[model samples]
Target: MSSAYPTAIPDPAEESAPTTRCRILAVAERSFREIGYQKTTVADIAKTLKMSPANVYRFFESKKAINEAVVERVTGEIEALIAGIADAPGRTAEARLREAVAALHRDTTGRWAGYPRIHEMIEAAMGESWEVCRQHVDRIGAVFERIVRDGVRTGEFEAADPAVAARCIQAAITRHTHPLLVSQTHPELEPSLVELVDFLLRSLRPAREPARG
Candidate 1:
């Protein structure tokens, strides 16, 4: 599937650049949150880091690069959480799927309410040819695909194509995960989270035998 955002750029930072990049991203995230991204500049981020603009530029080329790094940071956090849930011990696939979807919803909502400015950055990112957003989508989709394949292997789900099922599941929950959609969604107006999971699980269940007279 074509992506709505751009791909991530490979960075080969020197030994100290990693630490410096992290510092720059941290300050840029806060500035974006408190002051908004369009208002934040390379000079502002550098000043917050107590470094010269040239120093910050050494780690990040420009203002756009800094914002992309911050957005990628957010996507990386989501990927980590989804990976952890996918590999959680001793849970049925159904249970794990439910938990993963719930976590996605909560994280999306949290971004909108807790860090509206960061959420705004996400919205802007998705609307453009941002590779980080594309990579984010692919990474998270892979987690769902893995969980669905597990379900099929364990006889918890019956599917001709686990990848297709995974896509459908994510498509079903887009309202809960997409930054722009989540902000406009009212929780009460939608089916309860558990109810949604139950319906999706039913779609994966094996067909029941017909009763005969």
Candidate 2:
């Protein structure tokens, strides 16, 4: 697949700078998906795009830069998805939290699980493009925090610290959400997604008061 949204090959004279850049990233991301990022070279991307390597570098200084853009595009999408769920009106915080966690697991498994080599793309982002990965994590964490704060406000959850609780929620779902671990680990080795989400929700609920005399 050339891209999730493929465009026709660009004519240098006709395509705007942003259009050319998007074209390069589209080809580069396809190559990374099919061939793995370590082996997908600038020349290969340029060749596939019918452009010179020099032209490819006009937008991205290095393969790493192109990969960063691709990872950002992917993460930006999931972030928006989670953010929308976090802010959806007329939903309880617990409901939103469950949906958001399930969405992350579903998105991760759908995109990376059972795809043997695609982990290379995320591995590259985690190693060489860590700021991009870290920013994505932080954004996701912020969404969790928003939900936690809502739950606290509504007296549905008790947390001495919502930020800490949010990070805990993110950490708790790593097995379900982290691409590398999800791709590599067998399903039986870990708790089921529903089981895990239910456990997390239980941890977030308010502590019950003991019966008085």
- In terms of lDDT, the best-performing candidate is 2
- Clash count list over all predictions: 5, 0
Q: Please, what are the lDDT tens digits per residue for candidate 1 over residues 53-127?
A: 999887778777777888888889988998999999889888889999999989878776555566557655766
Each model's TM-score, in the order given? 0.84, 0.88
After superposition, the stretches of candidate 1 with alpha carbons farther than 4 Å from their true spots are: 1-16, 114-116, 127-129, 209-213
Model 2 pairs whose backbones collide: none
Worst 10 residues of 1 by lDDT: 1-10
lDDT per residue (tens digit) for residues 6-89 in model 2: 278756554467677878888887788778888999999999889899988888999999999998988998999999999999
Error of 2 at 199 (Å): 0.9
- Candidate maximizing TM-score: 2
Model 1 residue 6 lDDT score: 31
Every model's Cα RMSD, please? Answer: 7.4, 5.4
Candidate 2 TM-score versus the reference: 0.88
The residue-level lDDT of candidate 2 at 69 comes to 97
